[model samples]
Each structure stands twice: as structure tokens, then as C-alpha cells.
Target: MASTITTDLKNLSISEPVVIIGSGLAGLASANQLVNKYKIPIVILEKESSLGGNSIKASSGINGAHTTTQSNLNVNDTPELFFNDTTKSAKGKGVETLMDKLAKDSHLAVEWLQSEFDLKLDLLAQLGGHSVPRTHRSSGKLPPGFEIVSALSKNLKNLAESNPELVKINLDSKVTDIKVEDKKVTGVEFINTQNDKVETLNTSNVIFCSGGFGFSKEMLQEYAPDLVNLPTTNGKQTTGDGQKILSKLGADLIDMDQIQVHPTGFVDPQDPESHWKFLAAEALRGLGGILLSPSTGKRFVNELDTRDVVTEAIQIQCSKANNKALLVLGEGIYEDLKNNLDFYMFKKLIKKITLKQVVEDYKLPITSDELAEHLNQYSTAAKDTFNRPLVVKNLGDEITSETNVFIGEVTPVVHFTMGGAKINTKSQVINKDGQILAQGLYAAGEVSGGVHGANRLGGSSLLECVVFGRTAADSIANVN
Candidate 1:
């Protein structure tokens, strides 16, 4: 039962549909659950002309624990272990119940995409902050985010076509306000960007998934003042619209200052000063790349350390090297990440060269002998490395004058805002006093926080979207 709402604002004001804000994975996943499981009519409002939000830019895969894919690959992991790793990564600020739910449902989240949506997530890798390889993606050139978003968007469009009355997607519409009456959400007011006209839509339920405010300079200055000038990888629409709207409705925000800085945003040689930078996926290092101080030609941090830890190391190293560091990948890593490398090389963000060439072309401070010594030490340490304490192993063949490698200049960039409106385990948006703000208003994905306390793991962002997005929809679906 899918239907489109008429363009007439008056018609939308009279119809009470389940309205979901944002077209990211969270919004789409919630809509999928509502339409497929509950036969509910939905109206999704997106600020951008295209459907996919920042979700389309996610380069790394999604995290899952003890999935059939993991079992087949002989990865020994459990929800408990995943929970522990998450808590540790969060540095004790994590909400235990929310973290528990996230870890517990991760396996089902991945399986749901594969079984229900026909998305392939058979390949797995161990990203930073993981004890084992639980992040799943397809063995293809397309990034996991693009693949999942494309699949879900196409499916939703096809369903809308078949049942036009059940699903309506209004692109270029930005929700500006959430209306409340008798302490419950009754509707939302949004602006149609195309005509700069405001309209109100009556809805029994609203799912807020508008994403984080990483790109909002004002929000950054207010909440995370220290990161005001840092580069970011988020889309322009990631201005915390959902967070702002909910805050005005008295929803409590949690950990607003907890921002994540990714260690390896590529520093384009042609535009080194650009504020928008391309993220060098953590999968590159997970597959055996190493970060080196361009000045000293030495490894300063374990390649697989958490984003914050590596970012700190890179900052310190860059501070000493004129804000420059190099990420070097051997032939094995280059081959595994050939698609990513191809894009980077095409953009001139990285270079393919022999070890001697890297030394000579970049004018590395250390001699070839010193660089070889470091490579030998890393290769020796990575042998038989599999779980826990997350060591960098399998660094490929030892570096020699003739060895080939891919190298890119990298720097830390403001990546993710780990804070947003607070939500309960049921995915209901809550107030400052630990009470649900409105019966019909819910939040999930990056728009709602507290699942990740201080720092988020590399791949958990996507998992949060799928798990809580569905939870919010299911909670609304069962609410009579």
C-alpha cells in the first residue's frame, strides 16, 4: 500500500501519514519496514534533490557481529565481545542499554539487508576498534554505502510506482518545525525549496533521521569550538536540521561536544587548503597500509588503532612535519584496494611508485636503509596476527628499493559529530529529564546519539542507522 501525496499543500495538511524526514539509510530503512511489514503509508521529506543523504558518502562497510557471513569466514566473535569493544572505544560514556541493543541486533541488521533487500554484503574486514573482522561489504568496486543506498532507493521507488498511494517522497523539502499538541507530535512544517514556499503536513508519526551537523560551521563553533576550522567530509545538508528542530521541542541533546576526527583525509596536492576533503577509508589500513611521517619516514602509530588515537598521532606527527604525513600501501594492499586507489590516483591524491621513487620524488628525510629497517620491523610484527589488541600484521612483502607502493598525503579532518538528540532503547526521542518528549516522534541514525559515547568505531555508524531505523519504525508500527 504505497501512495503519493498531492502537491497541494492543503491536501497534505489534512492527510495523516507516517512522515519520515531525511532520505538517508535511516529514513529509507524505516520506510522499508513500515511499508513492507506494517502496510503503512509514508511521506519522506528530503532537503536535497537526490534521495541518498551523507549515507552515499560512507566509504567503509557496516559492522555486524556473529553473522552467518562471519561464521562462514571462521571469525570468532559474539555480541558480548562486540559490546565490550564498543564500550571500550566509547571510553565509558556509552549508554549501556543502547550499546547492548546495537551489538545484539547487528547480525540481524546485516542479514536483513541481504535477505530482504537483496544486497550483497558477503565480504568482511576488520576495521579500527574491532576485535575481529565483522564489517561486511560486497567484493566489488562500489563502496558499501553507495551500493546499499542505491538498492534501497530503487526498491522504494519501484514499490511507490506499484502502489502510488502508499509512499510519497518529496525531495527539496526541508522540515523546519515539529508541531506538538497535548504533549504529542501532531505534524511538521517544512519549506519546499523549489518554490521557497512553506507547507504543513499532518502526520501521526515522525521519524527524524536528518543526520549529524558536521558541516554546519555555526553548530561546530557553538558545540565543538575547537573543531570550527577543521576540514570535514560530510555533505552540505548535514547541518543538524533534525537536532535543531527537536531541541526547540525540548528534546535533550547528549554528548554534543563529542566529535570524531578521522586520521586519513587525503590532502590533495592540487588543493591542499580545501576545506572539503576526500576520506581515505580505514579499510586501506585494515588491509595492511601504514601511516608514515613524511619527514622521518617512520611509523608512529599502529595502523589499525581507533580513529581518535590515529588522528592524534597524525596531528602530532604532522605538527612536526609541516602538517604532512604519508599513507603507504604495499602491493598486497594496493591490489585489495585497487578501486579506491584508482580513484585517489586519478585525483592525484596518491601516487604509485617504487620505494626508491618515493624516497627521491618526495625527498623523504630518511635514507632507503632507514625506511627498509622500519618495514622489516612491521612485517615481522604482523605475522599470525588475528584478533584483539588489534595489531598491524600482514604488511605484505618487506620494503626494498625495487618494491612498489601507493602513497598519499593525509591529515586529520573533522569527520563525525558523535552527539545529537538523545533516544531511548525503543528509539523514542527523549527530553533532558530522561522522558520521552512526544509519543509520535522518534529518532535514529546520526541524528540521535548516546549509542556512541565519546568516539565512534569505524564501521558502527552504518550499523546504528539500520538497527535503530528499523526499531523506530517497528515501534511506531505496533503503536495501534
Candidate 2:
């Protein structure tokens, strides 16, 4: 790997550093590997004013198999089981090899972060479509995404401080074009948003981690037209800039039409019509929260079902109603999720109240007697008639008029794009013919796809960023 760096884009005489587009987890991971492990000079460009793209907003945790966190909890899990669960969740649309790679490296990815940065991921939970507990997060008030990104960002800043010429990170620099020569990427053309200046710099490699297009109205309309009108939980910086630039270079995109609509975006009563939504983490349901139809106050779908299934059920129910559903968490669940509950309460997205109080406060149609009967029925039943296990064994039975529960209005929102530029196991961008399109171009994270097919599991997004981001760095480092 090249170890020379040019501080200014105007200096054409100096050798170019390895260029990483986007400062999200994937891009930061790549840079970390390249500079720390390979001792390579690198430059990271981010379109946003701050670093950590949509990754910083991730509420759930990262998935791992047979991790130290899981082992400590006495949970038995393997990569094969994780693979089966992922493939099943993907619904036969995911690429088999990519899924295999992701599952196989799941443990190592978790360990890498723990060993390298000493980030705590001691808590484990079972998300939907998973048979066992595997998603790992720290037992802290701060979410996992913030912990991981902040740690990585601090590490990178330390590297930059020590070796100013070797590591450079420029915020508000957006890559507009890939400069290719002889069918190989050589550099990039970008605009410095601060000064409105256009510049070009030569580089040995370009790793695109610019992220998905969920927030892009034009891209959504073009690819998944049905999802254009839906609200998104993605950051504004996720406008498919990397995909658009790569596609122009003839990179074949796969599954662009497959978008994942997460079932639980908090519909703020203060601004119910806004398209930008704060995602209610899937862990909320995983931790024994139940979804109820606001009109009738009854469970409409299995809360632990796959996200797509739950989202479809919510959409259908909302179509008949006024696009409203209720997420009810028992006292035990609220106690377990005090951090998130307090935040939601501060945002006025959720309220702490008794069952009877909620009914009266929200003007629910169910009578107090009927609501008590319904809760008793759920509590006494071992499992639903459909054979789906209840979310929590004694959740419903524990609810009482004096018991305080957290309740929030939720609706389906556009969450993840399961499709983007096609890539091989090495994270090299490829074409439709199964051929590498550019020798010096690579991609990872949500910017490059085919890993998750029809739907993505709750915690796999962060795992994908770490696993493939490191893979891209390794591939680029090994390049002659």
C-alpha cells in the first residue's frame, strides 16, 4: 500500500493517499485498518459537516455469533445457525456466498472492535428471525452506534494527531466523480462545500462507503417507486451519491428495488406529518414490548416476527385506521429500557401511564373491563394459536391499574436499502457479468450491497459495515 500523502489537492507532484469516501463506520473502519495495520496514507471525505453517517443513528446493536458477549451469557450459538437465520430472514433473495462470509466472520468482527478499541459490547439480546440472543451492545445509557462510532472517531483523530501527513479527514467534501484511466480508478473529483471549490486528487484506491439511498426521493422513485412516499429514518447525507457515481462508471447494481421498511418509527404527536422519523429500535420489541391496534387495544401481529411481516401487518391495519398503532411496554420492560424510555419521554414521543390511564388519555375504544379481560387472556395463554411464542411470559398478567407502562405511537418507515452496487467477497465493485469493473475501486457498508436480500436483520447493518469495511481495506492493501 502507498504510504505517501499530499496535504493539498493542488499539489500534483506528491503521491496521492488512499481515498476513502464517507466517514461512516465502513469508511472509518477501512481507514483504521489501512493506516493502523498496513501503515498506509489515507484521506477520508465526508459530505456532511460531522462524521459518522447514518451509523451514528443506529439504535440497536451489532450481531455476532459465538462472541465473548454471548458466551459470557451462556448462550449457545454458531455461525451456521446465524447463517440459516440470516438467509431465512432474507427470504431466498440474498447472495449465498456473501451471507456465508458475513456469518462466518461475525465473531471476529465483534472481537476486532473489542480488542482494538476496547469498546464494551457485553449485553446481548435476541432480535426477530434469530433463534438465540446474539445482538451485542454495551450496558450503558449511550446507544451502541454512538459508542462504536465515537470510539473509532477518537482513535482516528489520535492517528491524525500523531501522523498529520498520513491521515487526513475532510468534512463537507463530497465526491462527485471517479477518475478512471485504462479501465481502472485512479482518483476522484470532489467539491469542497465550505468554500464551494472543485478539486481533483490522484489516489491509488477509492473505497466508497457513502451509504444507502433511502433518503433520496429521486432514487427511491426510480428504483423502488412504491416507497417514494414513505418516511425515512436515514440521515439527510444518505442520498445515494456513491451509487449514482459508481453506476455512471458502469457498476452493475443489484436488488435496487428491494427496500426494507422497518415497523417501528415513532410517530411524534407534535409533528405527526413529518417524513423524517426517529426509529424506535427493534430491541424495544425484542425486550418484550408489544404492538397494539390503537382503536381496539389488541395485539395485531406477533411482535417478534420478521420486520417485513410486522411492517406489512401494520400498514394494512393503518390503512383501515388513521395510520396509527400503539406500542405498549410493561413495567418490567420499561425498567429494562430506562435510557431509551427517558429519551422518548423527553422527546414527547412516549408517555408513562397505567393501562386505564392510557385508554382514557388516548380515547381508546375498548372499555376498561374488556381491556382487563384481554390482558388476562394474553397472560394465561402459553402461546398464541398460530404457535408463535408470546413476547414475554408474564408481561400481560403483570399489568395493573397502578402499574406504570410506557406507550408510544408507532408506524412503518423506510429504514434500509437492501440493494446497491454489486460486489464480490473481496468488496470489489463488480458488474452484471460477474466481472470486476474497476481494479482500484472498492465499496462496503450500505453503499455496496447484495449481502441483505429482501430484508435485513436488526443488528446486521453494523456488522456488515465492520466486516466488509475491513475486507475492502485488506483488498486494497493487497493490491499491487
Candidate 3:
């Protein structure tokens, strides 16, 4: 039922056992666990009328080291290996202990979402920077972050209906301020979007699952000045409301300068405000796709480099090619690598009208002989045991004949901050004074920081939400 608070209720006081702000995966997962385990009466305040925050727009899947499917296919992976790979992906800056905890608990998180939450996942193809294949995703080739959030939202609603002592949801409500008393949080002040009414909710605990400040101009200027001029794909609501609150609360921040630039996001080269066209997943490159520079008509960088390296290389490739940027994919590549990749992303690009138009506009050499030579060189260079082939080295006038190669250009857009409200292993938000702010006040998901260190791995954000979400619940249940 669509519900709204009227002007007469502007000063209403809602007292709950616990109050959670934000309805993303982190908030929903933590609420679900808390209500199920302790029967805690919780109120979830969400700015959007519907659930799933920025997660609803995710185009990628969660990364994990589950051996269920990939292991069955003889792809060996262990928690230790997963940890090491994640650190390596972050250029050795990730917190070792934190990554270890995530890897160790990832299987259980996956299990809970699948068995208890009714979320589905398929093994996603490994991308550049990892030694083994371990991405897990839902159907729709859509980002499983959305699926997980949607599933947890349903669970929250069900719990609210059946267990009167458990969770309650208030949508179209924005948390305007957090009320603090004597260094302890007492409640939150929220404004209803449907009407201009404001209400104060008193609670013993406050959990922030609001996402990063990807869409906040001030945050971009402060943390990621280099990307201030580029395009972004983050949701408008991802303006990092939680970060602003944490900053005001004097929370210590880390890695605010380290930002990941997703290279495949299609943005309007002319207008920066245009929504990021869905990014072709890096999984595509792992499945024999190619990254091409339209200016020089050549490929560059191993498609599998960490996002930083790939984005940097794309910039170099485009600069070298006279500032022209575009990507290409061979038709046969989809045929051979489709079954091994996300089919939705595959079909989206497979039948892309822009691709055909781009190909036509560039007048790329598509003859049988030219194609065969390019394939031979690409095949020869694509032979990395741990890395994808750097396609720029393989494209030549003499090369031609067989093999399909998909190419894409660069966005170099700063998407989100990898750092914010510092938290301990228990997901307790810590103050700059080196003490926990409140006994029951916890944070999960992107709002809680210190996990991704300098750079985040491909699918670790969602995994962080679920893993820490559960841990935060356990901690909150134990809170006195």
C-alpha cells in the first residue's frame, strides 16, 4: 500500500526499539537479520518510495569465492586465494584482516541469500586482475545487487506483516538530521517527501546503509578532484547523505582519494549529465572480447587489467589515436563466449544497434583477409595465463581472417568513494576520538568504510554489504 504522512503529523513522535536509515542491501540485510534473530522493533527510513537505493541500477554481479559452481568445473578457489586476489586487485592496499573476514564468510553470505532469501546466482566469468573465476550473479544479466536488495525488501515486508515486534518500513522519508546527546545518538529527524511534514523518531540504535557520495558535487570536489570534469553513472540519490552526516559527526575517513574509474560506461561525449549507458561488464573481455581505440584503429592494454590500469591505458590509447574513442567486438566472439558469460549483457551488446552504426561510421576494415590477420595476432597475444591480451599490439594491416574481438572505449568516470565512516570488524561506527559512538549504532554496506582500503575489487561492494550486514546484526543483537 502506498503510504504517506500528512502535514498534521509533522511533529509526530515515533518511538521504536531501533531505527535504520537507508534501504539499500546493507540496511535491508541488517534489518532482516536483526528482526529475525532478536525480534527487535525496527523502523527503516528510506528517502525513495521504493527500495533498493543505488543497488537497483547495478549492472554487475557480486564477487565471491564460492566453489559451488566454478569449483565443480575444476576451477580451484579458496578463501585465502580470494583474499590474496582481492588485495592484488587493489594494488596491495586492501586491509588484509578485513579481506580475510569477507572471504571466509562470503560462502555463508551467498548461502543465506540463496537458501533463505530466495536470490539466484550464476557463476560469472572472471575478469582482468584475478587468477580464478569467482563472480556470482542473478539472472537478467542485470546486477545481482538489485536482486539481492529486492529479495531482502520482500523479507522486510513479510517480517513487518507477521512479526509485529520486528521491522517497519517508512518510504518516501528522508533523514534530515541525526540527533546526538552527550556523544551518543538518541534518534533521527526525517521529512516526508510526499508532504512537507517532518517527524522525529526515537530509537536506541541507528544503522546507516545509505550508499556513497558518487553523485555529490561537493564530495567529488573534495575527494576525487580529478574526476570532477568527467561523466558519472551513479544514481542521483547516491549523493552520499550518510557521508555528510559522518563528516559532521567527526568520523575519521580513509582512502578518500582512491577512486575506481569504470572504463566501459557509455556516456554522452557531448553532454556530461546523460545517464551512463550500461557498462559492458569486464567479463566480456575475459570471454575473448577486445578493447579497441577508434582513432588508431588498434587495441590497447590487457582488457583484464585492474580498472585503474585499464582506464589509464584507454586514455593513453585514445590520446595516441588523436582523441577519438570507441570500442568494437567481433560477431563470432559472442558465439563462442556467450555460454561462459552473462547472457543478458551478452545479448544487450550482441544485438546493439549502436555497435553496428559505430562500425559503419568508422568504416573499420572488415574484410576476410584483414579480419583473419587481426585474429591471428590477437590469439597469439591473448595467451596470458593470468592476464587478458593487450589488443593494441595485435591489430595490424597485414593481419586478417578469423576470430571475433569486441572493443569498447573509456569513461574514466569517478563513480563512488571507497572510504567513509570508519568501522571495526563488528560494524560499529567509530568516532575520530577513537571510541565507538553508540553501543547499538552500527553501519553496513557502502556507508561503512575501511574495507576496500585504496581500491575496491570488481564485485566486492555488494559482498561487503551482505557479509558485514550479518555481522552488524550479530553485534546489534549482542548490544546491551
Candidate 4:
């Protein structure tokens, strides 16, 4: 774990290394499986100077069904239940085969992470679009993203030292082309960002783990023009580099227009208009937070519902004084979320403010009594417009002007793209016209769609990287 790797570009030319584009969760998961199982010669090409991509920024936990964590929590869950929830949330937009596979393999994926890196995914929370408590993280101070990615990165670094000839990591390297011979992927052309040297790796297998187009204005303009004005929670490197390479080769694309606008990107008071904003994690709401409208002091939507439903409610319901929604949490929720809140507060995404500041700063046109009545009514209501649970933990409790609470301004951001190159259950890329691509090529992660339908459930993105990334590695092993 102490070793570091920066492969000399010249050495890759002689090795015929299996090229994996992008160094995020998907690439790391694939490489880990390939090296562990087959000792396959591997080269991970990352455009960024660092390893972990947007994956390290993931705040919510990963999804798993019927895992040991769920069992320990005395939560009854099964793969069938998870699949049904996913299919229902997808609303017929998800590929049935892919959704079913994701649901079935989820627990194993979580188990793999725990065993492989000695990482604990023992903490569970019920995020949006989930029927039960199944999403998992560690019981540590660091967020789940950093914990999982750093463990995988550390393992790979140490492996590069111990098995230098079997594994190589090339940073600041962007894969520009997938060279094909006889309609089979043979290698890739990439450029070193540190120096402007163009390079190529000769290999018969290539896995596209490159991320989505959430941060690409041009790609958004081309594919999702209406969403171009929204902010994003993606890294600058997620400009659909893999999509461009696959599309030109006539690979099939799925749900290109089904972009997901996450309901809660924090609006920094100091810089509210910036296109890049910190995500107010869905876990914040899962652990009992509430969303309020400025025009009215009452709850606007079921804070625990699917993200799309909540985002639409905010857009239609929040008062026009600010294009934002008010998120509030009570003492109990705070106790469960102190670690995450500390990071958000340090980033100035959430902070303590006076009750008067709700009106003066957030522009919520409500009196202290009005706010109290809203809390009281929400606490006791049997049926509401949105049908949210009446007894939310630590929220809708007694409130005075002096009561301590956590609050923030949140807005919908273009968070995830549910569309990308099409891949089957086997993780083989398919042509848009419903044909399979070359045998040696594969795709996983956000770069490959159909795992999610119209909307992606919270915590499933990381699960996807492990499930399908390893699936691709297994496919490659079988092919060779």
C-alpha cells in the first residue's frame, strides 16, 4: 500500500496491456478482479492527474440487497424486492435484464468490497427510491466514496510494486481512440496531459469505464439541450470521452435524453450562481431531513421519495423569491449525521443561522408562528398532499424561535445521465441498431446505460461500477 505507480509510456507499447479507460470505481473494480483472478496484464489510463474520479465525491452509500449488514440491522430484504423497487422507479425506462442483474448481484458486490479491501460497509441508510434500508457505508468519519476508492487505489498501487509486470497505472493519460481491427477492439490511442505526447497501447481487449456527460456543456447541448443551464455535481473529466469513442464506431446508445437532475445541490450564499456546486447528499434526507417551500411554511414534498419526484416538486412549489428549496433537520438527525455535516459545514454548504435569517437571508416569507404551525401540523398529519410519512425521526418536532436546527439552500442540478452506450447483462457493448459490438470490447459504469431507466436510485451508481465492471472483467477472461 505504500508504493506508487506511474508507468513509463514506452513500456506499455511492448506489453500489449489490456487498456481500461478511466480510473474511477469501475476501472479499479475491473482491474482488481482481472489481476486477482487471472493475473492479466493491465493498464489503467486516467485523464486526471489523480486516481479517484467523481466517484470519490459520492456521499450517499452504495446499494445492496440482503447483505449481512441488512441482516444485522434485522431488516428483511431480498433481491426480488430490490428488483421490483428498481423496476418501479425506472417506470419502464430501465432494461429489464440489466435491472434484474443489478438487483441480484448487489449483495455480492457489497460483500466483495468488504472482503477484498477489509473495508466495512456496515452502516445502512434508506435513500430515495428505496423500499427498505439497504444502502451501506462505513461507520467511520470519512465518507463512503473516499473510503472505498482509497482502499482500491491503495491496493492497486501496492500491486504495481509487487507485480510490476502484471499491472501498470498511467495518470494524466486520456484515451482518444479505440483502434479496431476486423471489427474487434485491438488497442487505444491516448494523449499524455502532462506532456503533449500522443501514445497508443497494443491490446486486443479494451474496457470503457469513462464516466458521463454531466459536466459537459457541449455534450449537454447536443444531447440534452434543455438541461444545459443547470448546475452539475460531476468532475470536469466527465465529458463523455468514452461515449464519443464508442458512438463513432456505431455502438448503440441507450436513453440518451434521460438525464437525472438531482434534487439537492447546495446553493452557496456567497456564490449561488456557480455552475459547479456541492451536492447536499441524499443521505441527509434519508436520515430524517425535510424540504420546505418559501411561499408556504409547510413541507412541500415527501422528502424521502424518489429524486425526480422531489426535484419536480421543488421546481413547481418553491417560491420565486429564490430558485431554491429549504432543507431543515432536527437534533436526532444531526446526531446520526455529525460526520457528514462537519464536511458540509466546513465547505460552507450548511451552517447554523438565526431563525430571523430564514426570512432575511433565505427569503422565506413566513413568521415564527407560521413556521411553528407548519411543524406541528406536519408532526400530526395522517394524510398529506404528497403522502410522506407523518412521523419522521427528529423532524417536525416542537419548534421555538430559539430551537437549534440545521438548514441549507438546495436546488436541482444535472446530477446523472441515465443514457450512454448500450451494454447487455454480460457487459458487452451493443450497437444502437440492436447488434452486439466486437468481441474484445466492453463498457461499464456511468458510461454504459440501461442499468437505470428514467431515474437512477440513490446509492446504485457505485453498486453499478462493481457489478458490471467485474462482469466485464469476467467476460474478458472468458474471451481470452
Highest TM-score among the candidates is held by which one? 2
Q: By TM-score, is 1 or 2 better?
A: 2
TM-score of each: 0.94, 0.95, 0.84, 0.94
Q: Per-residue lDDT tens digits of candidate 2, residues 289-341?
A: 87878767777788788899999888887665566788887767765677888
Question: Candidate 4, overall lDDT?
Answer: 0.85
lDDT of 1: 0.85
lDDT per residue for candidate 3 within 1-480, as digits (tens), equals 334332222222423467788888888878888776676667889998888887665545676675565655577778888888777766655456777888888777877787887666755666666777777776443356667877888888887788645567889988887878876777788888888677887666788888887777788898878777666767778888887787787776666677677766654345435545455566566555566666545456677777777788777777654333554555545543444334434434333333335445556545445435444565555464334544433233333333233444445666656877888888888887768876666788887677877677777777888888878878877865
Worst 10 residues of 4 by lDDT: 1-10
Pick by lDDT: 1 or 3, better one:
1
Tell me the alpha-carbon RMSD of every candidate. 3.6, 3.4, 5.1, 3.9
lDDT of each: 0.85, 0.85, 0.68, 0.85
For model 1, the superposed segments whose C-alpha errors exceed 4 Å read 1-16, 382-398
For model 1, state the Cα shift of residue 480 in Å: 2.1
The digit string of per-residue lDDT tens for model 1 on 270-351 reads 9999999999999888777777788687777777878998888887876876566888887776556677889889999988
- In model 2, the clashing pairs are none
Output the TM-score of candidate 3: 0.84
Model 3 poorest ten-residue lDDT run: 6-15
RMSD to native, candidate 1: 3.6
* Deviation from native of the Cα of residue 463 in model 4, angstroms: 0.6
